[model samples]
Target: MRNVILCVMGVALLSGCSWAKNVQSSKNRVYFENLYFPARLSTNSDDKQSFTVSVDRIDQGLAPAREAGRYEATKYCVATYGNSDVAWVAGPDAPDSELRIVEGRLQFEGRCDV
Candidate 1:
């Protein structure tokens, strides 16, 4: 009985984090909703456009979250610079955004190439 209850709780937790899955075109509308989901862009002292996107809970892992972050950063850069070109700068792992869970938070980093 205890094992069954634990399994149920685990499934419930995973279901609640369905947002962590890759944002498909059918769910593009959802991405828009996450626009201001602790995501922001800032110009560094060197004039580099830095960006960061974070999600509280990640289900599938960091790859999907990183992809979503990159997408959001690109959108932001396009809106701010009339172009969507961007270059990843740094992340919790490496410059290429490796899988690393930090305090139950998933984050991605990049820089706009405006």
Candidate 2:
């Protein structure tokens, strides 16, 4: 019985590793300047048309962070609204002084236009 239990534990550990790999690969990620920036897009539960894109690791490069945020916002708009039209409230094209960064993450806000 102990040998059987050990075998089952081995199988479970191997499967867990593969499952983690699959989950990591399934994430929609963007590469910038040969590096991957972790960008995420989130929408307000009360207002689905408005969204925010946040890119982490801004210390690496501002240009890459901006591109990552823009890419994520575009992807979110396209996926949620079936179009890539976004009216930027605070976007990548804005001047450097206007960009929003908080806690090492750059954020962009926009509304998806139908």
Candidate 3:
């Protein structure tokens, strides 16, 4: 009986997290809603301050991938920058082409007037 209860409880708990996964913004107010990363930025960085900004600002980098990537584009936010590969633009003129997450960086699609 105990084992059965544990299994039911486990399943319930797992599903609960999926429903509320993307509840808060990232360090830069970038709004990480429904984005999945092998290692979350919160655990992969050294600076504690950078962890607070939710807005993802790729101020300096090698170069944004002009070409699309491999991963399914995550449709959310102003823009996303991760492993730093592709940058999908989510603006009024957003194109019909689907973006790929080359490394882990993402570009939110379907813009709304801010």
Candidate 4:
């Protein structure tokens, strides 16, 4: 009798999962490599304080979103999104790749030391 009760309870629980369509998804993903230079950000009258950033080399970048945990330009294209900051940066002249995200868009000025 206990086993029968457990099986019915399990079926109820499994069927209830079908009603979970309202939940937001959490699997959004992006990747970048073979970087494009000078994202060529247009000027916004400087009154807005639009900043600039750099990426030094291909292998020096550290974008964790890539499928292999590295930017693969041919397969991935790194993008910047969210609050503007000096992010995804490496050192200059040392396997360095700098990236910045601002206002939900990415900027790639150029190779930092390449």
Candidate 1: worst-modelled 10 consecutive residues by lDDT: 32-41
What lDDT does candidate 1 reach at residue 110? 71
| CA displacement after TM-score superposition, residue 29 of candidate 4 (Å) | 19
Q: Which stretches in model 3 have alpha-carbon errors above 4 Å? A: 25-114
Candidate 4 per-residue lDDT over residues 1-114, each given as its tens digit: 999999999999887775453332322223245443222222235422232332333343444222122222211222322222322332112232343444533443222111
Q: How many clashing residue pairs are found in candidate 2?
A: 0
Q: Write the per-residue lDDT of candidate 1 for residues 1-114, one digit (tens) a residue.
A: 999999999999897677456445345443423442233344556765776656544554445556556667777889888888877655533644454456776666677787
Write one digit per residue (lDDT tens) for candidate 3, span 3-96: 9999999999998887666553333332123332321222115622222112122222212221111122322222343332323234212443
The C-alpha TM-scores of every prediction are 0.49, 0.79, 0.23, 0.22
Better of 1 and 4 by lDDT: 1
Backbone clashes per model, in order?
Answer: 0, 0, 14, 8
Q: Per-residue alpha-carbon lDDT of model 2 for 33-113, expressed as tens digits?
A: 977889988898999999899889899999988998988888888988899988999999999899999998999999999
Query: What is the Cα-based TM-score of model 3?
Result: 0.23
Give the deviation of candidate 2 from the true structure as CA RMSD.
3.2
> lDDT, candidate 3, residue 27?
39
Ranking by lDDT: 2, 1, 4, 3
Can you tell me which runs of candidate 2 are displaced by over 4 Å? 1-28
Global local distance difference test of model 3:
0.32
